[model samples]
Target: MAPARPVVPADLLAAVLRRDAAGPLVTHYDDRTGERVELSAATLANWVAKTANLLQDEFDVGPGSRVAVALPVHWQTAAVLLGVWSCGAAVVDTPAEDDGGLDDVDVVLAEQDRVAAVEELGVEELLGLSLHPLGAGMTGYAGAARDFALEVRVHGDHFVPYGPVDPAGPGLLLAGLELSLGGLVDVAGELADRLGVRAGDRVLVDARAAEEAGPVAWLLAPLAAGASLVVCRHPASDQLKRRAEAEGVTATLGLGLDGIRELGRPAPS
Candidate 1:
């Protein structure tokens, strides 16, 4: 058999955005904040563009740069990762903790709640996100850190990278995981079918668990399969079944559903 061509994260993202620009690509619900937000492929790309522009124009971050992401499992986190990759930059995702080291990163993107801690790290450039459903600025929030919500919007919605992304370049660096730009996409493509995330399917995911699996389960996997996602954070055990039905979920990642295919599980022979 001929070897299959390698998949690239940027290529997959562009393809999906072109194929389903108007369709909803991500639907997110955060139980803790009682927030629900949805983004079409075009909308998500817009956010990615603005973020990338911010990184490039203001921070001079681009290909080969490493940005530490200190945020939780949130929709905005998705945009941040994609934006960095769009600029050919690698993501260093570490939980926002007081002791987390960001000495190696060119910039740091942190959550509002964790801003105080990272602020003391003396990182060169830091952006604090509120994770607001509307992408609003952090309320009554003030600090030396730049406000991502307020600044990102001022950037252009359409992005033009300084140069093409290098598919073989480093893309991500987690504690126990590492992948090149193409390697990340390769894993996503390989897992797409196995995860039961097929085209036209709406895959419901347990945000908490999916986060543990990294961007593969939460972002690239669905796009690699030509599928969309509904990420439920802090999902209510009682409302899962009803929500699945309401969302027309065809597959699930982590969460078990009676008829829905469960991802990361083998299918019946």
Candidate 2:
């Protein structure tokens, strides 16, 4: 019998882990910071497990819980997103500056530098990520928010949800759109097909595009299609071609490369 279709974002990741646990699932590059980090399916899953445990054990995040993520498009953000889904919680993707509807979120996770801004929102539970290339704790931060780098490592590497995750439960909320856990998986599959994401393809996407497209396109679509990702932040225009070649990118999104098959573009005749 064929493998079962994923019903939630976590299910999609579980499928990837089963297929290629040791293969690169996410490769992140930050040109401005001169940072490059790669996470295999298993490695990413480990981080996700730790994050889920932290949310569930520390903040009591579970079904019906909402986590406001005020971070940029980075590898850490990917882990946090999957972690929230694994807990059957909703991810409220909102800008750090915009706190209009975040008053009721159970927890808020933001970059360390944005902690001050998020604090003003009066959120009780706040976690800050240093976004260090080496996953180090936040330096010189004397704030009330907890340090995610320090706390996450102490959690178990394996995660078992406290209760059954309802596929119909809330999963993602962004830009006036809300999707249930199962709906996210369904849409991701549809988007993968629409974007022509092929199995085993290495897709390169710039930060700007990934941010505009959201996780459904930039993260889940590739995973749902059995593809890997190469996410570039602060992409240098002149160096994109060279970087794509070096990464062995088979396709691209929101970038105009000479030979790469850009998604949403017609195939060359």
Where is the poorest 10-residue window by lDDT in model 1? 1-10
Q: Which residues of candidate 2, in runs, are more than 4 Å off?
A: none
RMSD per candidate (Å) reads 2.8, 1.0
**Per-residue lDDT tens digits of candidate 2, residues 186-267?**
9999999999999999999988888888889999999999999999999988888998899899999878799889987889
86-127, model 1: which lDDT tens digit per residue? 888999978544337689899999988888888887776999
Instruction: Return the top candidate by lDDT.
Output: 2
TM-scores, one per candidate: 0.93, 0.98
TM-score of 1: 0.93
Worst 10 residues of 2 by lDDT: 94-103
RMSD of candidate 1 to the truth, in angstroms, is 2.8
lDDT of each: 0.85, 0.93
